[model samples]
Structures are given as structure tokens and as C-alpha cells.
Target: MARTHTPRSHLSVLHTSASRFASSPAFYVPQTLSESGDVASWKPISYIQFLHDVELFARHWAHVLKLDGIPRRSVIGMWLSGMTYVDVLHIYGLSRAGYIPQLFSIRLPNPDVVYELLSRANACALLVDPSFEGLLKSCPIPTHRAATTVYDIDSHDMPLPSLPTLRERDTVFIFHTSGSTSGIPKLVPCSSSWLDSAITKSHQIAMPSGRTKRNQDVTVWMGSMCHIAQTFMLLGSLQHGACTVQPSRQAFSSNELSLMIRDCGVNRLNQFATFLAQHLRNSRQNPRLLALLQTLDDALYSGLALPREEEEWAHGNGIRLRNLFGSTECGAMLLSTRGPEMFLQPLDGMSYAFVPVASQSEAGTSQGGHSAPLLELVILAESPDCPDNSLRAADGHFHTGDLFQEIRTGCYLSKGRDDDWIKSENSLRCDTKAIEDNIRATCCDLVAECVVVGNGRPSPALFIETNSDLPQPKLKREVLRRTRQFHSRRYLHERIASADMIVIVEKGSLPRTATKGNVRRRVTEEAFRTVLDKIYGTEWTGTT
Candidate 1:
């Protein structure tokens, strides 16, 4: 029998299918399932079978938590990794059952921190992957004493029943920000309507053609499922009925990813800049990638800035690399394709506004003592002025806290975060993004990622990850020389002299989240005090 394709104007075609299958058994397909003892693979599942699993899980969850009597909007926390398909199902099922699903990173430093976040969210139930069971057991929250219903996927013997239909406006998931620079990450509740909009917008911006709807075009993801970028891609692919290729437990090797790209026949590839850089560096000598490169249609880079040479290499290989700018708080914001103009175009159905940061403020705080500089984001509104604190030229636009400048006609280049700009003694200001761009342009093939941070210190510091296997001293000297050559001599002297130290690390040592690499966190934890002390022959507490 031929499957029917229903067209929708505002919603994605996949969302329509999901809604249509909510009550019908014929629509479910068991695409992902556990095979053998521990292995899992994608198998065809009927819409009815999938709904059965959802119902069973939802019923068990509600009964376990006594949610039968609780009101709607109750928070349920999900602390799991990306490998588990059940996590996706559980989230969707919970939303269908009228509960709010709070998604959190399992990378919390300690169990206490995890417990504190869940407790603060007032989560009524907690769904955990088996790997973190020990952490949960060690936490102060007693398993049997709390109102939370614990759903453990590893223990499949547990009882969980199914639930009925769900509402479109119901909150589906809640994501908390990483509190690296400020107070605790606040919970951002997401509704079905939001997901619908996000999925549609992402598909339009990413795939953008009926060709994407074809079965042969696979979507590749490298980041963790916890990160919104990965989440968006995973959900968007599933909704579009496109195949998704997930890397194994081992971090994606350049060889491995290159192979997967060819094997899966991936047409649309999305990943962080770091991942792409590492893959390119690793596959520099591999011959198979040339063929894989031929099959790839769109190569979308997000999470960080792509090195200029890497971008050129991809274009040289016939792949069009597009830059995606967005956050977990906001969905896809800006996209730039490979063209002579190379301007970032605002996504359709979404508008942006920006608020300028005060020049004197620091990176993680505003002049008013707020954590992080304040940039009002005006959503659904347009802006004519890019960085100035001018009055609203139009209504309905949000003022975004991110700093940006219109460098060319219709091209807005991102400066650093409002607080991340470094000011030299000569009163000259440097944007980290600009510095990163300069480093990429000068070093081209040597550098992977570079971060410039100035935190109420005398000199700004640059932390760089290099692709070459050169020793630390040689790499440091090379970086310093390049820095002097690329930047103005006076600017380099003022900045480098005021600069405390330059730290070089191997690729992949730096910490990265789903959206952006945490340069500050990596410096403080991995390089600064520990690595810098050994290199500089002193204890350092200069900057964050």
C-alpha cells in the first residue's frame, strides 16, 4: 500500500505524520531497537508499535509517580546520554502525557550538583540512563523517599504503562543553561508548538529542498544528544523521515567519520566546527574522503567558527559549507553560505534585535553586576543599526545581548559576547571572534581553535589548539611569531605585553559543549593554573 503524504503550510510534514499517528496503530514503525545482548540498530517499526511503547512507558511513569492526580505542567527531569533512543521516546511520551520534560547534561562535576539542579527545578520525576545509576544512588535524594518516579531504561523489567493523546502547546522539554559564567542555568521550557516551529525552520534553513525529502540523503551528527544542535538535527531528521548516522561510543576519528560519510551516503552533514576541523585534520591523508566528499551536498558548520582554510578545503572539494549561528535559548538564527559575498542571511519566520554592551564592562558580567553582559534580544523584530544602542527603528523586534557589527551589505559579523571583548591599555578594543578569524587566516593550516579572553586583567590571554604535532615550545614560538605578523605591531605589543601568557594544547583537549566550546572553562580547569604554572615558573591567579 502506498503511504499518503499530507501537506501542511506552517508545520513540518513530519509533525503532521506524528500527529496523524497519535491514535492510529498503522502509523508506528519500530525503526530503532535493541539487538543481540547490548547492541542496538535501526529497524522498521510501525506507527502502532511505537505508540504502544510510548503508551506503556507513559502509563508506567504516571502510575509510578502517582501523576494520575497531579496537575499538568509538573516537571520531570531527564538525565541521560545521546546513545539511548529510549530517551527520545520517553521525552515525547511524557509530553503527550501532559508532563514537562526537563533535559539536563550528565556531565555535572558531581552528584550533589546534579541533585541540586534537579531539586531546584522541582522535578517530580527523574528518568536516568543506567550508566549514571551509581551517581544517582550516591546523591542525597533517597530513591524511595521522594515523589519522583525513576524510569531506568537499563532495567527493562520495570512496569510502565501507556497514556492517551497529548496537546500541541504542552511543554515537551526544559533545557537549563550552563552556569559557567553566571548563576545557575535557568530552565527554558519548550512546547510542542516550539518544537514544531523549530523543526520546520531548521529543515527549511538546512535542507531547503524537496531533494532533502528523498530517502538517500542522510543527515550526520557528531555532537552529543544533550546539546540543542544535536537535538535539533536528530528530531528534524526523524520528522523528515530521513536517515541519521550516529557515531559509535568512541569519539569520531577522522578516518571513521570519513568512512561513515561515504558508507551512509550522507548528503547533508551538520557538526561543530571543532569536530569538522579534527575530522579534516585527521583525514588529510586519507584517499577515501575524496570519494565521500563527492557524495556530500551541503556541509553545515555550527557550534564554532570554521577555520578559513578548512572552509576553503571543503569548497575546493565541491562541498558548500554553510555557517549556522544560534543558541539553545533561540533556535537557528543566522546562516551564511559559500558565495563571493559571504553574508549571513537571517532565517525566515524569525527576526532578530541586538543591544550594545557598554564598552567598559567585562565578559561575564554587566556594569550593573549582572552575570554576563546584558543584551536585550528583541525576537520577531528587525534592526537597521547593528551594534549601536540606538532607539528602536521598528516595533516587535527583540534586542539581543550578543554583540555584532554589519561589516558589509547584508552581512553581520559576530563580535564576541558582550563581555568577551578585551580592551588594551591604549584603549583599543579587540573582539575574540575577530582575533580567532585573524589567527585562522594567518596560520591557515596549523591552528584548530583559538580563544582570546580578558577578565579584569592587565593583559589578555590566548589559548590555542593546534593540529600539528610540534612540541609545546616550538608551537608557542610559532604562534607568537604568527600573532606578531598577523596583527599590527603596536597592537601586538600592547596586547601581547599586556597579555599574560599564551597556552597551546593538542586538539580535542579543549572542552566543548553542543553549541560552543567552553574556552574559559577549559583554560581554568585544564591549562591556566596547572599548565601555566609549570610553564611560567609561578603560581598564577591573574584572570579567569
Candidate 2:
């Protein structure tokens, strides 16, 4: 029998993208933003050219590498810029040769973190970008620790080599989750089929038809190549026949972004909610800038939810705002545009076989501050490829620590993470989501984001990221007042440590998911350890 199209396989993506959209451009960086991170006229790279490059890379993998015919699939650790053509080809070519290509973040300049990742991955060979030279220098271990080695493909003296055949199930991408849990990385093994499924679904759901190079969802891939967002942007652009707006090495500023969108005829954005909010606030000062955003059809974000007013702002401006919900573990429980029911429905011949929801207790207080219990997500089979899918429980389902509620039968809404639950200083259980949600509802006008801290402390304290540029006293008062109100009424049993426990911080101060843009509670709590201690210590009870 002939090979039938399987679940989101990239084995065919290469052929289809190159053949079906042969004339279309695969990668585009405007002349204003060039390789040097300066204004320089450069031609776009077409799908054909991209494929030829992939061929070269594949050949390099087959013959040039010392570990060409290794027993196991070699893991090639990649350190490259976001959404670069080389990054795509490196991954595509490596996948073809049965090598797992894992990307490291360019923004993480810290040598220790980079080394820790490399050591953990045990990348047999590294394909590093020239810019990451400092990373090479900082390798405390013997550069070739154990059997590990390096291959600077850019400067390698080797010529073109033959390419090897790839098995559809040959690739399993290794992803390191954001240090959301105690600053330790969670290594996730997501197979190519799983990735292909995500990319295809994302392309099918997110990419609108009739998109041209000038009026396409020309996303400036802000997330690092390591992120799932990068996978969507890179491959989704290819499938959609759209152009990826590659800004300079640095992310586009509000002014620069506005100019780029206007001049480039851009149509989409994937950014942090806080970042977009700040830009919107900036736009108020320059009405012309705000007017420019009206051209976009959609803006996708992760991290903080956009305040209702901002959501209204997007709606009034004829833009669709989406807060994508999911984790590296669950492959996106919900997308912004689609209903939760649609997600659970089989997409492209792949289904995890969903199970019924059940009530699960955690260390934290219940749904209504120790009243109702949170419903646990018991996913039966998230993916066949992820053999290590621990989300699956002994009950033959992936019992997620995430709480959800079926609003009306099929439709569902995510409450928060049950795993983030912790005991408060006052002997009450608390979770970051409940605190953040309460703050957003009660004090939306006051803070950009209200992160609940003080895990294992006397009481939960608020790390307030104020929305305004104005003086702090009034905003502080507003937050304190709101906290008092929530404590008195909605969450009577779970009291928020007093006003003085609230610490006002600037925007972008807290850490967030690179892809989803969701705030990481554990990371944020750790970051404000001093403030947490203050809130839990002797001064906490006496705090003004």
C-alpha cells in the first residue's frame, strides 16, 4: 500500500512547502533590518533556496560529521537567533538525518544556565552561532566532556556529503520548560509527529486565507528558537505561504514596531500581554501609533491576560485578541480563536482520547477559598509519541494538575494550576491564579499584573506590577483597598496579608513563559524572596 498522510508529519512538509508553494518566499527580513542588525538592502529567501540549503545541511550531517553512522540518533544542540533560515534548515536537515536538533536561547547570556542546559541535554555535537562565542569560552568542563564535541558547521572545512533517509517516527524534539517549578528545567520529549500535529493545527486554525507577502501575518518571531511559538512561526509561515517579519537582532520598539507594521503592511502580532499593554499606553500619547494598530487583523499573546478595557480596545480597533492557554506538558489545552470543545475534538487524525473531569484536592485552599473543590483534568492519552507523558495517571488517563470547569457541557474554562497551590503564612492554602484573578477583577485599573507570592510564608503578599506611569501612592492604596475587599467578602477564609505586604514593581520585572507569555508563579515567588520573607516575618503582622 502507498504511504498515507500520517499525523502532522514534517517528512511531507518539506516536500509540500517546497513543491506546492515553490514560488513563494519562505523567509523575509525587510531591507531596513538586515543580518548586521542595521539597515541594508537584502533579497528574500524563497522556498526553493531554503530547500537547497536543507539539502546541503542534510548532506553535511550524513557524511561530514564524525558520528555520522552512530547507533543512536545524535542530538545536535543549536544556538541560533530567533526564526533564522539557518535554524529552520538545521532542524529540518537534522530531522531528515534522524538527529534531534534542540535550540538554546540567545537571550540567556548567562554562561551557567547555557552550560546547565547543554550538560542536561548531553548534545553529542553542538551547531553554535558565531555570536555565541562566549558560551564556548565559558564551558568549564572539557569542551568534549564525555563523548560530547562541537561542530562549527559555518566554518567547517568539509564539503557537501550524501543525505540519509529519515523515519517518520525517527525524531523526538527535546524541549526544556521554563523554570516555573523551583527554577529547575523540566525536559519534555515531544516527537516530530506531535510537533507536526501542533504546527498543522496552528496553521489550520490560526492562519487566515488570502494572506499575501505584503498583507500576511508577518510575525516578528520574538520568542527564542527553543520555544514552541518558534515552531509555529517557522513552519506555519511556510504552510500558509506567508512571510515572517524578521526585525533586527533586537526586538522592535513600540515606535519601530508601529513604523514596521505600517510600512510593511503587517497583519499579526504574538507578544506578551504586558508588552502590548505598554505599547497601547504609549500609543495613547501618539494617537497616530494607536491608529496604526487598527490595520492588524489579530494579536496573539501569552503570559498575563489583557485587561477587559484593553480587550475592548482591540475589539474597537477591529483586531482579535487571543490569550493562548496551554503548557509544554499538555500541548495547548485551548487556543484563543477556537472553543475548548473544538480543541478536544479530533484534529487531523490525532486525538488523546479525553476522559471525564473529576474533583481533586491540592495543598491550597479550594475554589471558593476552601468551599468548592477544583475540577481536575483527567486526559487519557495526550500523545502516543510522548512515551514519558507522565500526565497520564494509573487510572489510564493523564491526570493534569490544572483545574478546569465545563461551563456548558462541551465548553470549558481553565481555572488555574493545582500544582501551584501552597500553604499561606496564616495556615490557609493559596494558589497564584486565584490571587491574580481576584486582583485583575477588583483592581484592574490599578495594576498591570498582580502576582501572589509568599509560598510557605505567613500569608500571601501581592507583587503588584502597576499599569500607570503616575505616582505610586494612589495605586498602592487602590491595590490595598481591593485586597481588603476581596479578603472581607469573596475569599473570607483566605486573608491577604495587609497593604504593606504589597510591593509595587515595574512591568517586565517578573519572569514569564517565553511562548505562552503566562507568568510563572514559582519563578516570580523566588525572584521576590526578600519581599516574601518580609511579608512572612515579624514585620508582616505590623505592616501598614
Error of 2 at 465 (Å): 20
What residue runs in model 2 are displaced by over 4 Å at the alpha carbon? 1-8, 33-43, 61-64, 67-72, 107-122, 137-169, 180-183, 209-217, 249-251, 337-374, 382-387, 390-396, 421-544
- In the range 148-261, model 1's lDDT, one tens digit per residue, is 222442223455433323355454566754322121344555555566567666666645345345543466654545546666765555554555565543235555555455
Clashes of 1: 32
The number of the candidate with the highest TM-score is 2
List the candidate 1 regions with Cα displacement exceeding 4 Å.
1-15, 18-52, 67-72, 137-170, 179-183, 206-216, 354-399, 421-544
Each model's total of backbone clashes: 32, 13
C-alpha positional error of residue 533 in candidate 2 after TM-score superposition, expressed in Å: 20
